[model samples]
Target: MERVVSIDRVNNLVKKSDFISRDLSWLKFNHRVLDQARHLDRNIFERLKFMAITASNLDEFFMIRIGSLYNYIDYGKERIDYSGLRELPFRKKLLTEAQDFVRAQNEYFIKRLRPLFAENQFKIAKISDLDEDQKEKVKNYFRKTIFPMLTPMVYDSYHTFPILMNKLLIFGVVTVSQTDKKDQKKLSFIQVPQNLPRFYEIEHNGEILFVPIEEIIREHIAKLFRNIEIQSVNLFRIIRNGDFTLEESDDIEANFLEELKRKLKTRKTGRVVRIEVEETCDRWMLRILKNRWEIDEDNVFRAPEGGMIDLTGLWSIVNHTEFKDRMPDRHPQVPPLSYSEQGETDIYEVLDDRDILLHHPYNSIEPLLELLDRAADDPDVLSIKLTIYRLAKESRVTNALLRAAENGKHISVLFEVKARFDEENNMREARRLQKAGCFVIYGISSFKTHTKLMLIVRQVEEKVTRYVHMSSGNYNEDTARLYTDLGLLTTNEQVCNDVSEFFNAITGHSIPTIYRNLITAPRDMRQQLIELIRKEADNARQGKASGIVIKINSLEDRETIAELYAASQAGVKIKLIIRGICCLRPNRPGLSENIEVGSIVGDFLEHSRIYYFHNDNDPILYSGSADVMVRSFDRRIESLFLVQNSLLKQQVINILRYNLRDNVNAYIMNEDGSYTIKESTGEPPFNIHKEFYEVTLDDIQDAKLF
Candidate 1:
C-alpha cells in the first residue's frame, strides 16, 4: 500500500497543483479569528473575547506546534510533512514570519480597536494624563490594595538577575540623579504583582476611567528616585516553554499530582521562546535585556503601540456589563425536550424502542445526566463504567459516579489525566473518584484514551443486561453546550460487550482479539476503514453508485488519505467536511479528481466525526470520536459505531446531505490549504446547524404526541 502511494508520485502531483503549507493555512485560520474581533456584526464583548482567544491560541501554537518544529529541526529531521513539501528550518524562517504577523495584528488592535474601546467608555488611560484628584485616588488605591503585596528589587551586577515568570509583564525603570553630572544611571525592576488587577477603575466627571498597573508604576518612577532624573521606562514580558516532562526523581516524582506541582514551578524557568518590549525602549535598555537574557534579535519583539502583554486579561473587561452589547435571543434547550416531561420519563424506556440521537446545545444533555443519576440511586444497577478524557470542572457525571459507589454499585472511571490543558482537573477528579471508593484507572500511559463511552450493567428480570452511551464529544456538559456533537444510546449487546473488553484492556486486563460491532482503534479501526474504502473502489469499478462521505476536524493520516485518493481514482464520489488542518489534495487528475472537501465554521464549533460509505444498494453510517489522524487510528483508544437501524442511518445520511448542501458558512478547500467561501444562490438557503436544531425541536414535539 505504501509503495503504491510513492512520495515521488505525490510530489509530482503536488507540484502541478495549488497546495498551501499547513502551518501557513493555520495562520490564515487564526486570521479569520482575528477578523471576528473586527466584525461589527458581533457583540462588542464577544469580539473582545475573540481577540483574546486569538492571542491565547497563538501562544499555544508557539509553545506546542512551533516548538515541536524547532525540536524536529534540532534533531536533524528535515523530512517533509504529509503534503510532500519540506518545511523551512525553525527559527531560521518561521520566527521572522511569526513576528511579522504578530506585529501586524497588534497594530490593528492598538490603532483601530483601542479607539473603539474608548468610544465604548472602557478606556485605557495613560498615567501622565491623570489629574491631581485621579492621581490621589490611584495613590490611595495602591497604598490600600497594592502596597501590601509589593515586592521590589534592583537589578545590577552584584545581584543575580531576577527570574521573570512566564507571560508576566513587568516594569523596568532607569532612575538617575539630576545633580550627579558624571554618570548617573541606576536600573531597578519591579515585578508586576500577578495578584492585583491589570486595570484599576476610577470615576472622573461621572465617567469610568481605567489605568494599567504598569502605567501607574511608570508615573511613580520619579518618586522612587527623588534625587535623580528618570532616564527611561520600559515594559517587558516573557514567553517560556510550557511543555512538561515526567521523570522519576527525588525532587519531582512521577506521581501525577506531584509532577503537576513541579511543572507549575518549572514552567517559569523553561526555555524563553520570545520577549516583548515596549516600542519606546532605548537602545541601551534593549541591549542590556538581550545580553542578560542571551536572547537573539529574532526572539525579541517590539510591540506596536505598547500592546497588552497578555490579551487574556481583556476577558475581565469584556465581562463588564456596562461596555457590552445586548446578547442575541437564544433558544433554550430544555423546553423542547420537556414536551411530555413535566412528569418523570425513563430514558431507557425511550431508547428501548428506538435509537435516540442527541445533538447537543440544540438538545438538552439532561437526559444523559438523568440516566446516570437514576443508575446511581437504583438498586437494579449492577455496575457503571465510563471512559473520561475530559469532563467539566464541576461535573455531575463525577457526582453520579460517587453516588453509585456509595450505593454499593460497582463503578469504574477510566480517567485520561493527560487531556492537554485539563490535565490538572482530570487529576483532581481522578483523586476524588478514588477517594469515594469508585474504581478509578489512569489510562494506558502509552496512549491517551480519547474514546467517549459509558456502560451501565443493570438487572432485567433475573438476567443482567448492558446499556451503552457512545458519543463524539466528552461527557463535559459545558462543552456540550458549545460544540456540535452526536451521541448514541443503545442496548446493543454486541457493542456493550465490545466496550466491556475495551475498558478491561485499558485497566490492566489483557484481552485477546474479538470480533465486534463497533470499529475500535489501536486494533482494527484503520484496517477496517481501509477495507471499506477498497470495497467502495470495487463497487465504483463495477459501474455501481459508490461514494464516501466523512466529516471530521482534521484529515492528515497518510494511509487513510491514500486510500481515499485511490477510491477517488476509481470513480467513487468522495465528500469531506473537515473543519481544521487537511493535507489531502483534491481535483488532480488520476489522483483525487472525484474528491471534494468543505469546512463549516459558524456559531458552534463543528466537532463531530462521522463516516459514511455507500455499500452498493445499502449504506453504512458511523458517528464517533475518532478522526482520520494517525493519533486516533494507531495511538489513542477510540470507537466508531455502525448505524444498524435504518431510520438512524437515514438520519445520519440526511445530516451529511445537509452539510454538503450548505453554502452559508461552508468554505471549499482548494488543492492548496486555502478555502473559498461557497456563495449562496437565490433560493432560500439552508443553514445546516440552524435547520438541524429546528428539526430536533419538531421531532421532540412529534414524539410527545405518540
Candidate 2:
C-alpha cells in the first residue's frame, strides 16, 4: 500500500481507528450550531438566525455531501467511507444522522420558537388564526400575487409526471376529477416559486403575523383544480444531486462556459437524494414518491408533527426589520492594528510605509475596498489583476474593476467559473468584464482557483511598484462584515514580485519555478506543510520549545492528520481551532495525547486559515484560504502566503491564543470524535469572537506581543 490519502485507502486507515469520517464530523458541527440555536442565553432573533443557518447548512450538505455519496451508490461504483463502512451502509448512517438533525430542528422550532412568536408580537399563523380583515388581505394577496405564478401540473394516464424543482416548497394535491366516474386519484403538484416570499406579512395593531405561503396556497388551492374533489394537500421538498465535474478543455471560454450552463440545469433534475415531507401526510402519496424517485425510507424525512416546515424560511424573520433591534447588535468594527483613527486611509501610502494585516469583522473591510476604488481611478495605476472566487451581488469590487477597464487601465480577472453554487454569478460577471475589453480567464481547466489575491501595478514618480492584497476570504464586502477572516496588504518587493509571478503562472497557464514565500497547492503545499510539522516535531524531540497551532475551516486530509499525529507523538504540542469538519481524533492516550482540537461556532463564521509553527520560539505564521482538506490540497489551486512582518505575525499568534482560551463558542473534540462545549469553570468567560471585536490596543499589549 502506498498509504496515499484517497477513498481507495480510507477504509484501511479507518480500520486502524485513526480517523473520523468527514461527513459524520461535519454533522457534529451542525449539531454544535443547533446547540447554539437551542441556547436560551442568546436573544430569540439570534437563535432564529442560527436555526436558519442550520437549515442553510443542511441544504448545501445534501447538495454536496449526501449527493456525492449517492453518486457512488447509484452508479454501482465501489466506495467505502472513511469510517470503514461500504457505500450502502455509510449512506444509511449519514441519512439517519441527518434525519435526526432535521427532526430535532423542527421540534425545537415548533416547541420552543412557535410559542415565543406570540409573546414577541410575531406569530406564525394560519388564515383561520388571522382576524377577518387580515384573512381577507392575505387571501387577496395570494390570489393576486401567488396565484398568477403557480401552475398545477397533472400526472395520470394522459399526463406526464411533473419535474419538481430542487429545494422548493411544493404542494402535492391528490384530487379526484368529478368528470371521471372511476374517481381515479390524480396527483398534481404546485411548486412555490423561489422568487416569492416565504410568508405573507401583515401588521395588525403592532402584532406582526406571518402567514406561511403554503397555508395561503392550501386554503385556495381548490381554485387551481376546478371540478376536482381534493383528497389531501401535502407539502414536500426534495434535494437533487448537484455535484458534477466539467470536462477539462484547453479552450475554457467557449467550451466550459456552455457546458457549465447545461450542467446547472441538471441540478434541478438530478437524482433525488432526500425528500422532506410534512408529518401526517398521505402515506400513499409518500409511497408513490419514494417508489418514483427511488428514494430509500431513510431518505424521506418527516417534519415534527407540524405541517411542512421549511426552517430556512426562518431567515426572513431573522432579517425582518421589526425584530432586528431585538437581535444581538453587530458592533462596529474597529480600525486594524496598523490603521490610525483618522480620516479615510490612503491605502497605497499605508502599504508603502508598512504592511497592514486585517482581521475581518473586528477590522473594517472599507480599507481594502477603498484600495480597489482608489486604484480604479488612480492615474499611477497601470493594471489591476484579481482572482475572484466569489463576489457580492451588488459588488463594489466588480464596479471598481469595470471602472478601471473603462479608464483604459489593463484589467485582468481570473473568474473561477467552477466555484460551486456561485458559478452562475461568476460566469455572468465574468462575461460583463469580458465585454468591457478586460482580459478574463474562465478559471483553469480542471483545478478550481480558490486563492484570494489582487495585484495592482502602479508607476509613480518614474518608479514601478506592485501593491498586493492577499486574504483567507473572498473580496466580497458584504461577507467581510459577517465572516472572520484575515487579509494582508503589502508593498514588500519580494512578496509583491512573488504575487506577480503567481498571477502570471495561473493566467498564462505556465507553472512558475519558484515563489519567494508562497506555498501553493497542487504543487508543493502539502509537502511544505508536512515538512513544517516534522520540523517542529524534530525540534521538540531535541528538547527545544516547539508547538503547532492551526486555525482553519476544515481539517480532513488524512495525510496531514497522520503528520499531525506523528508530531504530537514526538511531543509537539498541537492546538487546532477548526471551525468545521475535523477528522483528526484528539486526546487519544498514546496516539494524539498532545493534540487539542477546538471548534468555534459563534457570532461570525470562523473562515480564516492560519498556520503557525514554533521554530524554537522564533515563530513562523502563514495565512490564506486553504483548509487542510483533500480538495484544498489536491484538487483546488490554492495559495498560502508567509507572514514575516513582526506585528502581523504577533497579531495572528494572539489570535490563536485567544481562540484557545475561549470558553464560549468553543467545542473541544474528544477522542471519540464527539465535541464537549467548552464552559467556564469558576473563571470569567472569554469569547474569542467578542474579544477580537472589543479588545483595545492597551488590552492586547497586556498579552505577549512581538
- Clashes per prediction? 4, 0
| Candidate 1 residue-wise lDDT, 621-691, digit = tens | 88899998888988788889887866566666767777887876688877655567777867577777677
Clashes of 2: 0
Question: Cα miss at 351, model 1 (Å)?
Answer: 2.6
Worst 10 residues of 2 by lDDT: 1-10
- Model 1 residue runs over 4 Å out of place are 1-22, 73-90, 128-131, 174-188, 203-208, 222-229, 244-265, 288-295, 321-325, 334-344, 683-685, 696-706
41 Cα displacement, candidate 1 (Å): 2.0
Model 1 steric clash total: 4
Candidate 2 residue runs with Cα over 4 Å from true position: 1-16, 177-183, 341-345, 697-706
For candidate 2, write residues 316-364 as lDDT tens digits.
8889988868976778778888776424756777888998888998898
- TM-score to true structure, per model: 0.88, 0.95
Residue clash pairs of candidate 1: 18-672, 19-672, 176-228, 177-228
